[model samples]
Target: MDVEYLHHGVPLADYQLTKADRRRQDEAAQVHEWVQRQLAKAPPWSEERWERMRQLLGPPVPPWELQRWQLRLYCGHVVEATRSRERPRPDGGVCDEERCPECGMDPAVIVAFEPPANNHSPKSSRFARRPPSDRRSKAELVAENNALRAELKSLRGQA
Candidate 1:
């Protein structure tokens, strides 16, 4: 099969990637290996584990899978790439500066959060803490309201 090849700024199959490109590739491969090792620590990762990894990585997985995996396992977290200002239009009628480069239509925004992987607190722990003093059960509140109303009615009749 005919093949087209490009390397760095150079072209053709003979051309090789530049020093920078090789460095980047190496780093990426290292990360991939790291991720595999992390996974290997446990038994074969299940589909759910993969999905959780994806969520932690966020959309568009980063070049370093190992770092991403570490972030996932440490605590459920996602990192967003930094966004820069957009460019202006040619005619000057519309501009890209106010809008996002990724979506093009919406303004750029960053959101980051880490949620606990599981609510694994013990069932016995629940009873350890006292409920709020101000809180009353629905039934108790309703009954109290009925009694008040009855008392008010009796007072009105006496008047």
Candidate 2:
């Protein structure tokens, strides 16, 4: 038997990822774990339960997971991070003016809330549909629309 070494997209080899890709993958894993935990808490889903879960998990970070940005500070208060314009200093050096607007920390400390490895469900989905607990059902809405149309017809006839 002969040994072959392949470098370009070959199988049985570790692939390299860029910094951005690695960051995105890590973020996705964290968000997935958080979502799974939240979902588990609201099992046998309902609209109210789903909404509560959404509030607890926050909004989806977008493009990958369903979670919100929870900015934690050293003071133990939760806040949001925003981009700010650079300010010019006396030495003509530019500084990042971005900070926690709530606490006004020059360099806002970021605290990530990553769920533990065992908290995630391997068979879960990234997105979930709303449960059948909304106030108005589709059939009810359709019947109400028909009733309104009939009432409008009667009013037009009287006019």
Q: lDDT per residue, candidate 1, 1-159, as tens digits?
A: 111211121112233335654454455456656877887897877899999999998887333221110011011122222111121111113211122333442222111112122321222233233446756899999999999999999999999
lDDT of each: 0.36, 0.42
Worst 10 residues of 1 by lDDT: 66-75
For model 1, the local distance difference test gives 0.36
Clashing pairs counted in every model? 0, 2
Compared with the true structure, what per-residue lDDT tens digits does model 2 show for residues 8-105? 21121233434644464455456656887998897597799879988999864553232223334333344433211121111112321125567664
Candidate 1: residue pairs that collide: none
List residue ranges in candidate 2 displaced over 4 A. Answer: 1-72, 75-79, 82-107, 110-131, 135-138
lDDT of 1 at 17: 38
- Model 2 accuracy (lDDT, Cα): 0.42
TM-score result, candidate 1: 0.23
